[model samples]
Target chain A: MPTPEAWAESFTEATNGDAEIGAHGKYYSCSYMLDMQERKLIVDMHRGRVENINLDVQPLDAYEFALRAPADTWRGMGEPVPKPMYHGIWAAAFRKNLSMEGDLLVLMQNLRCFTRQIEILRETGVPV
Target chain B: MPANGRFSPVTGRYVTIDLEDPDLGGEYKVFFLENGEGRPLVCQHTAGCHNHQWRGLLEDPDITRSHRVIAYDLPRHGKSDPPNDREWWKEEYRLTADFFTKFVVALCDALELEDPIFMGSSFGGNVALQLAWRYPDRFGAVIPVEAADYSPGFFLDWWQHPHANAAQVCASGTWDLMAPQSPDQERWKTWFYYTQGSEAFRGDLSFYSVDHDLRDKLEEIDGERCPVIMMTGTYDYLTTPEMTAATAARIKGAEFIEMQDIGHFPMSENYPVFKGYLEQALQRIEERIGATVSGQR
Candidate 1:
């Protein structure tokens, strides 16, 4: 079973030097959740930087939103070249394959950052 | 701290020149900006909009320190005055490759800029292609964003609507195709288009949608002396990635890059993503120049 914990290092590798993320201002800070299968990923972002990513932890809840989808859907979204509706989180939501709950503001605020984060999963090959 | 808070105010100046075509020939004031120092980097704005598109490049320390970024407002656009003979709105306004080519070379000569790197977006992109084809050895490199040989159906009802409100409607419709995520940028772009001289957008479209076509002329371009890079944003509905890719394929040594999650107006819509692509393209140009120098040695 693959956990979000196993995906953190790879996610960091894909995002750190990305031009878009680096240009965002210092006030851009947020946290969110990615729920697939039985695990929940709590990703912490500060000043447009990915600070921490924890998995399967519920002791302290600091997440602004949670994006839930079938594990198979996550796998489809994880494909190197995702098909039309499977390419991005917004697209997945639009197709009704993924449901977003809580703080829609934060999710939309950091949409590009989060979108690129998941796309990086394709590069990481973490087996979803 | 210029009028726009995001970037520095570029120094604006005007140069008067005579047009080649007698029917359209007259003294016209061409407005351009000169910012920073080093090798010249000439930027052309998209149709309708002014040189404000290059605000980011004008302020970027990395780009400005090594290159003098010069952006000009096309005739009947921004601060550039109209030709003495005709009114831009009342008469049929059209742009031809011949006139565009002459204007670019003249601008260079007037400013004493030699072999500057040419960078443009949309209609500006099409003009870049024309420049490359006309003067193969005149430019250092050609970087055209969202460039395509032809953009069919870009103006479906562009000038067909009621004259009074047509410009607003056209400008408003484009707002959706710009950066969907960024509101400030959208406002800026819409305002840029809205404030254009009536029918001026359509005038430039005459080139983008009608006159400009280099599909058969790509062979004439000397890619070795002037490296051509066609960059297309993924979200550009008018000039899609497929179109740019096809154009690049025809040119033997041209490079095509698809910018991710970006739209038609990259510099205005998604600066970071667009800048990333620009830097990468510039790096590639540097490598090619170095290799050429070494090869000749």
Candidate 2:
């Protein structure tokens, strides 16, 4: 995962003085609100095609934004297998518009593992 | 014994850079800084890095005056050669950590060091931590700078994610992600490039995740008579100060220092600051050890 400094640098470089990106907490490197808005514009420009957009965000934390991402882009970034919470969140967000898949169930299992990992981090006082 | 000289024993793969210590009755690798007296501070370079990595420490006359510093190239790096058959690279790939551990032990034994202090940067730092963790009895103190704490999911994530420098890592395989310039560096690069590409090494990459959480283990070290110091740069993307601080807080007496305006490789980027910080840490270790010895006496 990129450090908050790296995320801020990248965000600043991407926006080029147009906007300022700041860290909210340990888990989220860049400002979630700003990232969401920028992602929306990129998605719109790509005609809602997720693959056409470059998220340019921290790869590990991409799951935060994956919920609002197009299905194809979400799948391309490892789908539900790697980050199940993200998949779950995506499913819940698009449940009315999309159908759930069996692989996604497996993703739920992986998400459980992710949660366990997070718990471990918390127990160890890793600040997420 | 010669001062500031080089030694290439045909039997050994590496050409040792010897920093002469007349009082010690032998010449050791350049990785060590010798006080014109006999006392020495030993250091080992991480894979694909060199003695120059610790050049900052050497440049500081105060540090050099007090401690003899020694550093050497690991097999297949620096002056070290690739195994004659090259197949040995594959066999040796899995043993990098073990080899280094043994190397440090042997060096200490050969030097008759009662309890030597160790300082490492990057991969060297990881090796140093592991060595201390496994054999806390052997070291007086340890300082790991930007050492990686790989979890089970780290590599899998790396494989899945499209990295900014994926192509380079994929091509070289060795963890010397830092760019280098020089024939010596190129030689080091080739060593990493080959070993990282080896199949045996690939499987062993999972070893990084084997002990994902070393907080408890480090805490035990803190309780020991020996001291442990964790150092990192504020801007170090690879190993941030926050991570180092967390690691430090876990250990009972582990000291954490964050060098400002520096990144992953502080020894190279902020040499003066790194040297100053290291000297301070060593002074603390010396005082602690002295107090312990005096109390026993």
Candidate 3:
């Protein structure tokens, strides 16, 4: 299982200079926290680029938004061969496996960037 | 149990609307979700689908905060049951322009929404234009995604004359035109295309493929009262961007936009990719509303 720092590094590495991400991501600038029971990850996107990913922030009350899903759900999502609902944020949300709270519009507006970051962790075989 | 057990992310309830009466129907209830506050935005779904298509937008606090968003399932499509008066079971349930217009007007009246911006996709997209043409002042703006005045080449007679199974054909045909990048399971899953019963899909297609033609009438929709922004996806083969652009050219001030890497099913398939384009369109509508309010003052 990848530590929160390792997952953050993988996300930064994947989307640091992607052009399409920049285009669709232009409308977003927000802070989001992802909770995986034992571990928590926070991603800060400034003007459509990954500004930082802080791992030590456990409760994530400082961020504008937070998404909480069970560790099993995150593990399934991060698996190399993820099941259908486990692959994407919307899918998980639709299935009621994930609870998204706070600035929903910010999360949706920056959905692509956030989703890609999670996928990057999966691609890097990061343990939840 | 609702068809998909999918309730609206916002208020989960069914609102009553009189379909039979010219005035709002007090008899029948149409399933709808209304969320947030501000100027109302009435959203409609594509054929054979329900209002759940707008879930992502409904759930978004930013959009909901700025616009009172409402989306409803047409009669017989979702939780709203089929009409009792009509022998709908004996014949295919064709969606007529009259039925569509009345439903919309009645729903708006019931909700006490005045001049809400109307947004729709595919079959619902075509209805948006019809709504503007038929009742010019009823709407503030009409944003029709993947729509055209007349679909010259796309054929759906296969829906009725089944050399192959109609349900399978409709599902597969829809899958092809939907977001190519969406998961295959999502593309073929019965959830997306299987609602509204078996013949309902074919019945709706008759309106989409044959009855719904607004070629000359496009010019009749006033750009001021009902500002139109025609949008189509680059990947939508059924209603090509070229077709949507041609339709937009007929209106004096109508805007046209092509959503990149998107297909016919904007909400269901490849949502994150298509949402960016939807946001842009909504922003444009907001700008027009702002301008109109400013000018009137």
Each prediction's whole-model lDDT (CA): 0.72, 0.45, 0.71
For model 1, residues B126-245, the per-residue Cα lDDT tens digits are: 888888888867788889888887875554443434523455444544543453443465446645555464456777788888888887887777766788889987667677788899
- Residue pairs clashing, model 1: none
Task: State how far residue B139 of model 1 sits from its true place (Å).
Answer: 0.9
Who is ahead in TM-score, 1 or 2? 1
Q: Tens digit of lDDT per residue, candidate 3, span B1-297?
A: 588687545886777655674322235657888787777888888877777777777887767766788888887777777765555566545667677777888888888877688888888889888888988788888888889987533334554444444554445445445544566555544344553344566666666777789987888887667788888976676677888999989986789988876677776666676667777877887787663232110
DockQ-derived CAPRI band for the predicted complex in model 3: incorrect
Which candidate's DockQ is highest?
Answer: 2
lDDT of 3 by residue, A14-128 (tens): 7776665666567557898888777787778887778988878744258888889988988877777565456556546644378888876555445445655566656766436
TM-score of each: 0.65, 0.52, 0.63
Instruction: Tell me what fraction of the real C-alpha contacts between chains A and B each candidate also makes.
Output: 0.00, 0.00, 0.00
lDDT, candidate 2, B1-297, per-residue tens:
579886432112223322222211122232233322224566765433445555556555665555555555544444544334334533324334554566667666765666667777766677667776677888878878876443233233322223223322332232222222213343344333433433322333443434334545665554245677778765444455776777667766777887654444556545665677776777777877752232110
Name the Cα RMSD for model 3: 17.3
User: How high is the TM-score of chain B in model 1?
Assistant: 0.89
Candidate 2 Cα misplacement greater than 4 A, ranges: A1-128, B1-38, B82-86, B90-92, B95-97, B148-216, B291-297
Name the docking class for model 1.
incorrect
